[model samples]
Target: MTSTVLTGISELWTLDPALDDPARPGDVADAQVLRYAAVVIEEGRIAWTGPAADAPAADAREDLGGRAVLPGWVDSHSHLVFDGDRAAEFEARMAGRSYSAGGIAVTTDATRAAADARLRDLVRDRIAEAVAGGTTCLETKTGYGLTVADELRAAQLLDALIAEGALDEATFLGAHLVPREFDGEDGRPGAAQYVDLVAGEMLAAVAEHVRWIDVFCEDGAFDPEQSAQVLRAGAAAGLGLRVHGHQLGRSGGVALAAALGAASVDHVNHLAAEDVEALAATAARPTAPGDRPGLLAVDAGPTVATVLPACDLSTRAPLAPARELLDAGAAVAIASNCNPGTSYTSAMSFCVTTAVLQMHLSLGEAVRAATRGGALALRRGDVGHLGVGARADLHVLDAPAAIHLAYRPGMPMTHRVWRHGQEQPLAPVPPTPTP
Candidate 1:
């Protein structure tokens, strides 16, 4: 394949893994920044990155007009396979009603009712929207389809997209909530039976299509013990563990995740000081490499505290304690948590801006959380940084510096994007309905 040399970059935030110092702990510092830089891309990998003056000759050369560049955003939590909008529920929440996990059933009905082709179209559109905004690597879950058949369909759809390189990670979240039918009233089986299905038959059917499994460990959903049951089942099936934890209260998701060696625990809106310490403690554990293809190392890595800023804002919930997590030596990631009931936009830039302006993270910290932090949460090392041999995923910005992401908040700053060495069309997608 022919190589391309990209020049005229005013600032390049390489975030090269090679520059990460073990002594600094969770700091992704400005030491990795390079000025007057250029990059060489060959065979969809970064062949070289350094001063523009020392750039070697290549098959093609393009100037970026002094714009800034960074690794494409890696969003590690989202729900894009579903087929409906929850604008009505959102409006209710904004009009003084509180958010609840019950809203998940509304989405489940619509997603289950959608035709296979329609659901595929909807998910593809959402992925395109995310890419247009510079999200190159994203992980989506299959929680909207509560039934065995519906969940299997969603998983298969995401698996196909992964095969085609249109998506990155797929997770099985069959324990999202107990569907209305399983409420256990008037002869219906209760949450216990539902949990059994998730840990047994449902998991058996979709386990081949997904790499990770997640449970909503909160009130009105699976309790701590039930969540543990499901996570253990997935682990037995050779899947990495993830958790939808502590979003609405002081749930036991953090303790459970750390104990089970889960890769990530998202929506941490209600963490306690002890919960922070538990996650930080996991950072010192040595990671074991995955023995199978298409799966993460299930037995290792820190339980990343994935803060969903957009979801917190839309639900009127307290922002996650991202600052404290980082300060305490715990790993942290920023994600959109894009879903129908709460967060509906796949804009990682907006999430990063919120992390900086509201969550008290510095620009570098926020960007790193949204990119490298996310990659670590998913246990994938190749896409988060622009190090040598990393995927050629570049997010070229309209501004000269990355700080403009927050300084010029809400402005359209994505000048261009390239994923895996090929340019992506930034066609405007319809504005995702907000809560």
Candidate 2:
């Protein structure tokens, strides 16, 4: 196959533990930064990567002008399958009105009322926008469409994104919230009847088009029992599990996620000591084929604690305990959680910067969490790292070092991005909301 040699790389972070690095000794410390490096891409895969001096010549050559390259950001959690904007709710939260589950209904109503063509255009733009911001692998869910028909349509829409090579995973989040019709006599929503639908026909309808199932297991959503039922049903239907847990309060969501063996539990801002311990154990547990339903394996990976810094900031909630999870030996992942209601930004660079400056993660660790950690969270090993045989998903930075992502916050850090070896441009982005 023909190949192209990318030369003049100042720093290339492979995020692979086995790669050589001279800066730090430990596996975590050595982010596999190769200075003065060159990489060969052939047939949409990394054919060779090493120091420039020992690099084998390729059929074609391209100079990078001394840039930094890392694995493209793998955004493993988001809610990008809806219409309408939540700018008013965001403004209210900024004014100290506090975020609540009630706001999801507004988006749900708008999504259901929107024409299919309008929603598809919106999803397409949002995904292209994320890729321009250096996200190579996106995992978005269908939650706003609570009914069976709408949920299936949303799933079909996500399949279209997958065909375009923009999205890597699709999740059915029919249990994201209860519609107004399901409000209990006590006036609470998503309490009982809604959970039944999510665990039954809704789950079956969306399973064919999706690879994962998720529940909003918190106050004003499904309780522990309801959440567990949905998880077990999804697994029975042969779909992997994800959870929107612990964002609102310490409602036993973390513990439930561990017990049920979710692929990754997103929004971990309320983890207690026991929750941490349970998560560590889940991360270390081994799974083989034909295991019990709770421990069914996804790419033979552990449960991951996914933190959404942007979502926390937008909702004014506490940042997830990423440091503590890392210290406890639990795998941690950082995601954009890009949604209209909670997080409007699809900028993974912003998320990584906040992780280093505010969440107390090292630059290496933060990048790892955003890339490899995210792939592990989804239990897909082929996309996150730049190992010799891995996919050619590359993110080239305009700066010389990865630290500049955190150092120069709020700037366009990406120089060029390649997803499956297609060079993505930096313009024709999503339109800004008009005032």
Candidate 3:
């Protein structure tokens, strides 16, 4: 059997709760042991994990040299595809101009004009950069390509990446905005028609490549009623629903997402009290019999409330209601929301820091949101925790504990990374001098 061992961990944040009874609730919110630990990997899955001294023997071993070990980060929301920059729009916004969802159209135009080669290259480079910084699993959305052809091409590129083992998750976001061509006399297409076109044609063309269907449900983008239609159609097409909600204003994005039972409602910068109540209500409910939810069933699974701190940092908008969500007992997740107009950085560490400092989440809560919460948001259980039977994906931090990820925000603290039982070289080491 293929096997490898990782030893000398200074601390391990398994992100799995230490439960009194393993057969009971998983206790996903409470972290498990923080003891010094080592992990064993076999056939790309975790075989054993325990105290360093008790680590199981493997065919080969690599000492981590007392580095902090934690599950590889899972970034559940991001718009990583597209071309061109929005620096000018950002500069203008900082110079007293208000932010508008209209900037998405500008990027849509540029993305439509860009060649497939350039878009693929940019996405590949960005994914590599994120992986080097400790992200083992990430979700990318295609929003800038608002047209059918462009959106399909974007999904094709994502499929190519996945086939080549470059990235993991891909989402189709044709409802990101109404392209200039569709901007009829009123600057938007007929709501029913738009949803039909996207759900029937564009979505069908990329259905095999995309797992989630996303829409920017804001005032200047698609309205609540329009977004609901899109969500319903996407549900019919067997794609999970995610939303870009309430970033610029209180657009009922949260309520809409909850009503439709979306996998996650992202960018909750304008959540209302009712929205908080809805999230908390779902959190208190028991999980459905099967771990996977039935497709198109309105009440199949709990809706995850995801906060995009990097988006707030770029748009200068109020932070997502993270504190209120947690206080109300809602299951919350944090993501980079990496895009051009707002939140262009892929640093989950920075996102965690913003959640703690600006959104008032405790260090532990922020870490949980970035790890287990992300997995919940993506409706997956095997990637964000270092439990046995999970994927052998982990991050080795330069610091001694997971809290340092937020404590030292802007520094490059990710020293090494491991994926599928193989340790990746962080940097080339020089040859040893002759004895």
Candidate 4:
């Protein structure tokens, strides 16, 4: 709870967009970008921020040597609790071949084949890479485990990581795909029965560990009806709902997600007119006292849209309709969608660049989408912005302006990172000994 003043920031992109008062929208688009700004951190929250000359005195001071300061990036969608690699499949897809939902089964096999120790290590390593890249908050899903035992194991792994203070959020994605062993050709069973088994048993077992449930609702994956069944069952089991919708094609997944009041409909690459209308309706919908929806309502929140640009970069897929979504009055968030086959990287910086360059998002829009918009997608009110009372999580940029993130893509711009008011130094690795 020590109060510290971080001075000598060349530029502070508060990401709050409110200069006069963070509660009210300010001229984030035209504000001087605050040269030589300083910030005060107290009790793991941003206490005050302004011109360096006006910085309040504190118990201690950490001069950043004129580095840039910005709120930490929040990655709201990722499948991080799995094992194995799909390099061959990725190479094939890069060589003019198409990707399908079935490719997920390959990773499923490998994840199920991995030992608990290995799986935990793999996830821990990925998360470390993300944190070093300035990702302060992230959401990871369990999709590779297609069976009851394997799914439970994935959940158990996530629980262990959480208990060990590794992962911040965990999701249950037991309906990621119809495993080959569950198909009729494999002499196992049918898809409907498999969905029921997952919804009834596997979901129940993992419910205690997961905060959300997701389904790959596509053509080759679970159909709309099947996906609905899984989501409904998960809701009945008290788990929040999310959907993998319209990444490959138009599958009515976005509309279905809005109907189910999902936390966020991810990969909305094929939204139709109805989908836009649905998003508008949801954003306009009012919530109750606690900002929770009424039981009978099925409205998506203010940030009704999420654009996963990394998936497009990896799979050669079309970018999400970011301009259309924003123009239609729907808030949008950006995520890495980090996975083995498609998005193998956990760099939110790359996602911001892709959003601005490929999806026509402005620099401010893309940054907001990566931070506050992501928090809205997750329905988390306290972790994305740099307002008072929010978590003291932030990233120090190596550049003087936030525009450098997109202006100079594919570069290491993160100078330092702080989580919960504590500065995290890079851990040293042992050097190789001479043979």
Candidate 5:
């Protein structure tokens, strides 16, 4: 196995707590930054990291000429497998008209009508965009296709992406909406019958292909009972759990997610006191020494409280209580819920910046949440941080410091990206937004 030492890095942000920190000792920080740093990549994993003066000799060496490097962003949530334009809705929202914004049903209509090859191309292109912008691992769901066929097709495509070595996680969201055909008396629709279909046929068909199951437990989506039915059914089908809760309003979404041992509860913009406690408890875990050797990983501890800042800002919804969750010891992840309807951007850098500048998080806190926290949200290990045994997933920034991600706003900050020791060439993907 060949080893390469990347030396002469002006700044290196290592989220690994075990690394020594002469830069800020006794300062009580969540992360470590090394000056004149060097990292050795061997056999597709980080073999060594330290000051360049003491770096062990490697099979090869490359001087970075004083650039900054950090763990590659891990986007745990997205909606990259759908198509169609939602521009008129975005335009209306900007013009002071409150938007009920066409939800899943609208996207389902478009996605179901799209060709399989086209959908495959769209998914690949979106992943390419995320990678180009520094994301190494991302997870996308299958809610745009509600019917058994549509849902299965979406899952199959995602599975193909996973097999082809792009997307790392696929989620089954068949219970995302109750579909127009399920509408019934009292103006609420036959949600119960729709739940039955999702729990039975839909769950059985997509379970084998998906790694996790998610339900939109918002007020206008699935109620508490229906959400529970879907989650229970998904668990029975051997899938992990995640929930889209309370983006619209407080509808007991967080409580339901915590009660069922969900891996993550996302879009927590309207949490109550109890909801906060539940989330804090869900993210709490005892320290472990398994795959990580001496770091913290859980068999199943507290739920990961994921906050989608871009989606919140896009929908004009209140930002999630990020500071509150972090203060209470909850593991919170920041993700670019990059979907067409709510958050139309897949720039994890933008999401991290919003978290630090608007949401009142420290730069280190924001970066880790966008990276390591995201990995935890997906129940994945060894890919988020630059731990010794972790995969060599890193992003070298064009700037000299990590704060430049926020300070520079929209500059092309990513200089280079390496995934599993493979350097990815920069490719310009086409504009993703609708006209």
Candidate 6:
């Protein structure tokens, strides 16, 4: 493999785990954030990173014109396997109607009606949009397809993308909600029967294609008990656990995620003090060694509190307590939750900006959460940081400093991108709406 030395980097936020302070592993100290840096990429991995002056010889060299470089954003929670838009529902919510989980049923109907080839094309277009905004690693879920065949097809599509190197992780979310036909009003199966179907036949079919399983643990979705049943079934199927928790109310999802050792619990807009404490406790749990190649470790660790900023804003809901989660020693990640019903954009830069500005996180904290925190959420060690021996994923910004992500929010900042040492062809990025 040809080696290249990248120079003229004004600031390089490697966020290398080796340079992290053991006393505060979550903190992004200055040591890991280098200035006037140079990096060497070889064989689709980071060979070295240091001062530009001390850079060593390489097969080729490139200058970034004093721009900032950071590890590409790792978006760990999204729903991208759907086929329709909810612009009318969003307009209704903006016009005084409250958001509810029921809107998911609308997307489910449309997704079930989409052709297999059309669904694949939709997901490809969405992934391209995410990459245009500097998202290099993404995890999307299969929840819109509520039936056994549809869910299995979504999983198969995602698995093929993984093989083609277009996607990272796939999650089975058969427990996202009970299908409308299973309302139990007539002779149809009720929510309980639907949960059984998901935990039994549906999971058995899609388990091999997905790396993790998720359940919507909230009112109007599945309760904690039903969520637990589905999650335990997923665990028995040899898949990692994730949860869609606490977006609307003080649901018991937080405690359940902590008790069950879920890898992540997303949409934590309403969290109690005890909920924060329970999630923080998971930070001290033992994690599997970080040597696995292209696979998320399915063992025990903290349940990452993944805050979806765009979803919260679009739904007119309270922003997640990201600042408090960090202060309480819990690992926190920022994801786009890109879906039709709520957040429709795949702009991870916008999510990071919201974390810094509205959520009271410092720019470093926000960037780290969107990158490394997302990696931890998925229990994957290889892609979040630009550490030595890590994947050569780079996000070169047009600005000279990283602070411009929030300093000049809503601007196009992605200058170029690289995934595994290959430069990606970027599309015209859409500007984020100013908050």
- Per-residue lDDT, model 3, residue 58, is 89
lDDT of 4: 0.79
Candidate 6 Cα outliers beyond 4 Å, as residue runs: 294-296, 429-435
Tens-digit lDDT track of model 5 for 164-196: 878888999988888887866667558798899
lDDT of 3 at 264: 88
Each model's Cα RMSD: 1.9, 3.4, 5.4, 3.9, 3.4, 2.9
In candidate 1, how many Å is residue 429 off? 2.5
lDDT, candidate 1, residue 188? 99
Q: Which residue pairs does candidate 4 place in steric collision?
A: none
Q: What's the C-alpha lDDT at position 363 in model 4?
A: 82
TM-scores for every candidate against the unseen true structure? 0.97, 0.93, 0.91, 0.91, 0.92, 0.97
By TM-score, the candidates rank as: 1, 6, 2, 5, 4, 3
Residue 350 in candidate 6, Cα distance off native in Å: 0.7
Clashing pairs in 6: none
Clashing pairs in 1: none
Q: State the lDDT of candidate 4 residue by residue for 295-349, as single tens digits.
A: 2122335425788998887888888898888777676789999999789888998
Q: Tell me how far the alpha carbon of residue 156 in candidate 3 is from the true structure, in angstroms, after superposition.
A: 1.4
lDDT, candidate 3, 299-341, per-residue tens: 3567888999988878888888899988887888888888888
- List the lowest-lDDT window of 10 residues for candidate 3: 20-29
Error of 5 at 209 (Å): 0.7
The full ranking of all candidates by lDDT, starting with the best, is: 1, 6, 2, 5, 4, 3
- Per-residue accuracy of model 6 over 152-255 as CA lDDT, tens digit each: 99999999999899999999999988998898887888999999999999999999999999999999999999999999999999899999999999889999
By summed lDDT, which 10 consecutive residues of candidate 6 come out lowest? 426-435
**Residues 1-435, candidate 1, lDDT per residue (tens digit)?**
799999999999899978987776556656678899999999999999999999999999999999999999999999998877989899999999999999999999888888898888889989999999999999999999999999999999999999999999999999999998999999999999999999999999999999899999999999999999999999999899999999999889999999999999999889889999999998888766666442347668888999999999999999999999999999999999999988999999999999999999999889889988898899887888899988899999999999999999999989999998999999987743422
Question: Which of the predicted structures, 1 or 5, would earn the higher TM-score when compared with the native?
Answer: 1
Q: Clashing pairs in model 2?
A: none
